[model samples]
Target: MEPGTARIAVDLLGGDDAPAVVVDGALRAMRADPDLHLLLVGPTEVADALIAALDPAERARITVRPVRSAVGMADHPSAARSESTVRAAVTAVRDGTADALVSAGATGATVTAAVLGLGRWPEIRQPALVATLPAVAGPVVLLDVGGSLEPRPATLARHAVLGAAYAAVAHSVVAPRVGLLSVGTEAGKGDRVRRATDPLLAVEPLPCGARYVGLVEGYDVALGARADVVVTDGFTGNVLLKAIEGAYAMAGGPPVGGGAPRAAALLGVAGTVVVCHGSARADDVASGIALAAHLWRRRATELVSALLDGDAATDRTDRSTDTEVRTS
Candidate 1:
C-alpha cells in the first residue's frame, strides 16, 4: 500500500476460472488498496462486466484492454486471436502501461511470455520462479520452483545468488542462510547435480550478508531451523512444494503459524510478476495480487537485479585471475 499508484495488468482469461476469478481477485485488491489501479486484459464483455459492477467513483481507477479470444483456445489461433491474453499482458508491462503482471495460467506459458517480452538479465541462462514460504522464524525463499527444470551446476549456483538477493530485498532478511536442497544434510548427498552444486555454492559470493550453509534436506524446508533460502532444480522444487501443500492438508491443516504458500514470485524477469497455483481459489488470487503489490512497492525487482550484477562482476574478476594464472 505505497502512496504511489501501481497499475497491475490482470489477464482476464489467464486463470483456470478466467474472468470470474480474475474479476473477484481484482475487486478484492481494489478494495484493499486505494492506490491500486487495474488494466483488465481479456474479452471486452468480461472487462465490461467488472466495470459495470463497480461504483462510478471507483470505475475511474480501472481500465480495460480487451483481448477477445477465449481462454483455452487452440495454439496459433491468429495474432488478433493467436496470441494469448497473458502474452498481451506482458506486452503491456513492456510498453509501460502496467507496473506488474499476475497470472494463474500454465506456468510454462507465463514464463515463456515474460522471457520473450521483458528479456532476461545478463548471465541468466534460465529464469527462476521463486516462492516465499512463511516460516516460524521468518519467510524462507525457495527458487527454481518451475523455471529451470534441469539447470546445470552453474545455473543452480546463480539461482542461489538470486534467491539470497530476493530474500533480503523482498523480505528484509538480514544475513540470510542459503542451502542447497538435497536428500541429506551431508556434503556428498543427493544426485550428481546437487552434489556438484553444493561445493560451488560453498565458495560462491552471496549478497545481503547471506552465507551458504551447505546441503539441506527436505525436513529443513518446513522446520526452517537451518536455512532461510533454499535452492533446487525447478522440477524437484515444484513437486516438493505441491507435496508439502498436500501433506499440510492430510495433517488436518498447515501448522498454526503458517501453511504452504500457494503463490510464488517469478524472479529473473524485468517486471514485478507473481504466479499463483493453477488451481487457486479466489482468496489465493487475492493473495497473489497483494504479493505483487508488495514487491512493486519495495522495488524488489530492481534491487535484486543490482545484486545479481554485483555477483556477475565478482565472477568475471575471478575468471580473469584464473585465466591470467594459466597464461603466466
Candidate 2:
C-alpha cells in the first residue's frame, strides 16, 4: 500500500504446507500492495498456479525464478548450503535482483542462508532475529527471538544497542527505553547471564537517542509500560515470544492492535530478510511478505548497520558461560 515499489523474493516451498500456503500468501500480498512485485523462487508449476489465479493487472507484477530444490523442515540448517529454494532467494537479494526476501521455512535454515549469502555486520558476530509486538502504549521491539540462543554477555549488550536503534528507526520511538528481560525487575534478579549483561547494558551507548532502562519482567513485553526494546538471550527470547502468543490465543485473541508477530525481521545480516513461522498460514505468509516489503522500503538493514558503525565497543566481560539453547 505504500508509495514505493518493493520487489520481494519469496521461497515458494519454504513453509510447512509448501507451495500451497506460500502461493496463497503470495497471492494475498500481491493483491494487498499495488507496488509489490514478487519473484517466486520455487517450482515452475507453483509459480504458474499463482500466475493463473491473478488477473492481468496483478499478473504483470509477478516474476518467477524456478528452483526445484527445497530443504525439508527437519533437515539440518547447513542444508541451505545446497541449491535449495531458500538459498536461491538469498542469492536474489545479494545479487540485487530483489529488494528483500521472505520465507516460512525452518528458522535455522533461513538464518543460515542469510548469514552465508548476505554476510553479517562487522561488529555483529551473532546476527539477531527481531520481532515487534504491538503493546498497549506502542510497539515493543524484542530481539534474539531465535538467532543466537546462547550468546555471551557481550552479545546481549550488543543486541540492546541493535534493538534501541531498531525502535528509533523502524518504530519511531523517541529516546527509546531499552531493558534487559529477566526473572524480576530488580537489578540482580535473574541468572548469572542476566546479572552479567545488566551492568554491561547500563553502560552501552545506544544510537537514535536511546537509553537503557535497567531490568524488566516478562509482563512488560506485552504491556510495555517499562521499555520500548527488550533484550535477552535467544533461547529465553524465543520461549518468551511463543509464551506470549499462547497466552493471547488462550484469551480468545490478541490484544486490540494485534498479537505477537508470526514473522520476524533478521537484523545484523547485510540484507532485508523476513523469517515467518514454519507452520505459517496464508495470513502469516502474507504478513511476512508485507513485513519484508516494509523493511526493504525503509532500508532497515542498511540503516541499522549505519547506526552501529560509530559506536565504540563495550568492555563487556566474557561471561558467555553456557546454556542449553541451540543455534545454527
Off by over 4 Å in 2: 70-83, 312-328
Ten contiguous residues minimizing lDDT sum, candidate 1: 74-83
* lDDT value, candidate 2, whole model: 0.86
lDDT for each residue of candidate 1 in 1-328, tens digit (9 for 90 to 100): 5677888888776666655887888888888888888988887777888888888878999988876555445343323231388898899999999999888878888888999999988888899999888777888888889898999999999999899899898899988999999988877999999988988898787877788999988887777889999999999999988898999999999887678887898888888888878777777788888888889889999989888776666645585543333222
* Tens digits of per-residue lDDT for model 2, 43-111: 787789999999999989999997755423335342342238889999999999999999988888898
Q: Against the unseen true structure, what C-alpha lDDT does each candidate score? A: 0.83, 0.86
Distance (Å) between predicted and true CA of 165, model 2? 0.9
- Model 1 regions lying over 4 Å from their true place: 71-83, 315-328
Question: What lDDT is reached at residue 309 by model 1?
Answer: 75
